[model samples]
Target: MDGSIKVKNLTKTYKGDVKAVQGVSFEVEEGEFFAFLGPNGAGKSTTVQILTTLVKPTEGEIFVGGINVKDNPEGVRRNIGVALQETGIDSVLTGRELIEMQARLFGFSKKEAKTRAVELLELVDLTGDADRPSGKYSGGMRRRLDLAMTLVHNPKVLFLDEPTTGLDPMNRKAIWKEIKRLNREEGTTIFLTTQYLEEADQLADRISIINQGRIVAEGSAEELKRTLGFDAIQLTFETTEEAEQASKVLYGIGENMEHSKEEVTIYTENGTQFLPELVRNLDEQHLSPKTINVKPPSLDDVFINVTNEEKERV
Candidate 1:
């Protein structure tokens, strides 16, 4: 099986001929944590479904672990573990039973299945709850069990679509830790999809932002943010008149700089260079900037900018 998961010219169309995914292409490297981020209707799930062979693409070339997905989806399934957003667990089964069953279904011997089940429960920190009925488990525990089930085959690649979505803050952090451990210790490749920007920023080695069925941006968080330069300087004023006066002084710093209410925001290339001059100019204008803050563009900002630009073109 090839280590990399590659997709070329992928597209998905519904019955009404509405395109869900359009010509999306990317590569997930061997043993890398890659994230696909977008809003609810942005084709993220459609792409995952196509790649994992749950749904066929209208047009595309997909290779998972070097096996042609279209030709041998079962082979691709054998090599990949998928923990979808929806948990597929039997409430009647005990946690241990669930894991054991998954292992057995993957062709593990009885003894090996039990041992692997124990190991997985321990790794996911659900060992203490192994004897409990799955119906009694919490949302987070259920999610962990779902992931454990997916790993019964020790798949090389894991597809996690919003694994932490409904969990509380603590549970979310706990799941994040387990994900990191799985990647670092077992060297598993993970393809993640999430609506949370911070999750993508924190976990992904590289991020691809999708919108309106197309990839609008792709890069490391820092690299994409750097492209926007250091913009948006915030300033406080002693008085409304003073703020208004300061706004006029640094008007040229941005394409459409503005001073609204109490703060003056200017988009500039070199914030530091512009700061000193801005202060001096404000002083000349008989105004004082009580607080100054310069924030570089963030992934959220980039998402908004790029998507807005796309909307304008239409």
Candidate 2:
């Protein structure tokens, strides 16, 4: 538990009566990959800022690596590394110079700083371009350089806020691979925040979804999806009339139903078990669909369900 984080009743309120985070509580075990997920303006950034000591919480407490954030902000900072959404590296500096400077700022000797710089360049797969000015680097390369700079201190915990936000799919996957490797090989604790459902599903050992300054759900990706305990079967018809007609016959078989102009989605405990009956019911109603698809519950479904429920309560 050396690199663990403990948060209790954390709250942050900005000026103009804005409440960014409200009574949030969670824990991240040592060496764990934890994801904080939400839409824009959901307070994920505010929470990360609080945890990283950039912002003070209005209520409650947070401890990083056994150090109270408010009591010993420097201690908390010393043990953690942060790579924010924005690439803050100087455009004039080469990748090697940036990392070496970061290491030197962390108290490494000149020789040690150079050694750490080379090691990090290799770790981030930027060795070939280590001497190139960062201003000329692509978006993905700049992100990699930022990550390397964050690790120059060999911190026990890492905070990545939307680390792959603007990258293409190929670059996003490459960054994901590097993050996974670091967590696995270095045993570093990771706290990540992102809007991408696929990124959380792929990277987090556990996830917490925040909405309107509150945590609506927290669990493993599979666990959250399983909580729905149903599969979805989507049927696409020629028109809304046919879909509405089919819905009437298929009403009682599923727990929930959603219909669009030309499609109807049914959520049931077992889609395969209900498929034949659904088809027969539609046939009897003289309704035909253009396509049918069944899929297991996914993280997107969990997010939609939780956030929608929260919205209804508000």
Candidate 3:
């Protein structure tokens, strides 16, 4: 690809007639933190595997760092570092040893490899434990070591697949901080694949959501939330009938104006304006809601709304 990455018309199919990716296309710019997000079995791993040259796409043109992966996969491999969802670090090997091996695989001299190993251990906050066998490290420490190994090759681009899958909140935060620092200080373009929306929101400059082997949404976190409107208002009443009446008053403003046993939830563009109008209508109908809450739309809401829209069309 002339750019950092370019994939066009990508498709992947497994046995039993299952299509994993369907005509997926996207371009990642240099030094960008791009996230691939999706529910389980949404073809995320398939796409990553193709881009990293682990699996060939059934049909597509994939280029990484200006090299066509299908044609010059070796070139692509030389320019990219991949930390897969599965950690392949040798349990018996010390963190320093694994990093040294990775550096030499990329053709580093023995002295240069040793120097880089120490640097990466410090970069990933593993300097103190660099001599410990990977089997004795915590989950977060192992992940950091994996990342250090990936960076030992000094790739222009780094691929991280669910890098913080099973870590405590504190450890997850620590990893997130280092990821941002890597992108900022080293100018390493990151292709992060994660299931957690919050992780993408925090780290990705742009995010693409794939579902059912197709892209459902793509944008920055704020832009995706904007597509779902500005606010979500919850109105709770004393009875279901009162909630139903409120829905009629707010019908045109919200589509999924759901009414449960005693509450109604509505989507609106400007909840501040809509709430007053809703209150007036409810009073005229002899209904008074017991509670009203207005909150900004979130990425979770955007995912639910966009995915539901896709399902209905199917």
- The runs of at least 3 residues in candidate 3 whose Cα sits more than 4 Å from the true structure, single-residue gaps closed, are 1-3, 229-265, 269-300, 311-314
Q: Each candidate: what lDDT? A: 0.84, 0.88, 0.85
| Model 1 lDDT at residue 1 | 74
In order of TM-score, best first, we have 2, 3, 1
Give the winner by TM-score: 2
The candidate, 2 or 3, that scores higher on TM-score is: 2
Stretches off by above 4 angstroms in model 2 are 235-249, 259-263, 269-273, 286-298, 307-314
Pitting candidate 1 against candidate 3, the one with the higher TM-score is 3
Q: Estimated TM-score per prediction?
A: 0.79, 0.84, 0.82
* Candidate 1, lDDT over the whole model: 0.84
Please write out the lDDT profile of model 1 over residues 217-270, one tens digit for every residue.
Answer: 889867765654446677887778778878777777563365678877776677
| Every model: Cα RMSD to truth | 4.6, 3.1, 3.6
Among residues 3 or more apart in sequence or in different chains, the pairs in candidate 1 whose N, CA or C atoms overlap within 3 Å are: 1-65, 2-65, 2-66
- Identify the superior model by lDDT, candidate 2 or candidate 3: 2
Error of 3 at 130 (Å): 1.2
Candidate 2, residues 136-252, lDDT tens digits: the string is 999999998999999988889999999999999988998899889879998999999999877988999999989889999889978866665578898999888898888888887
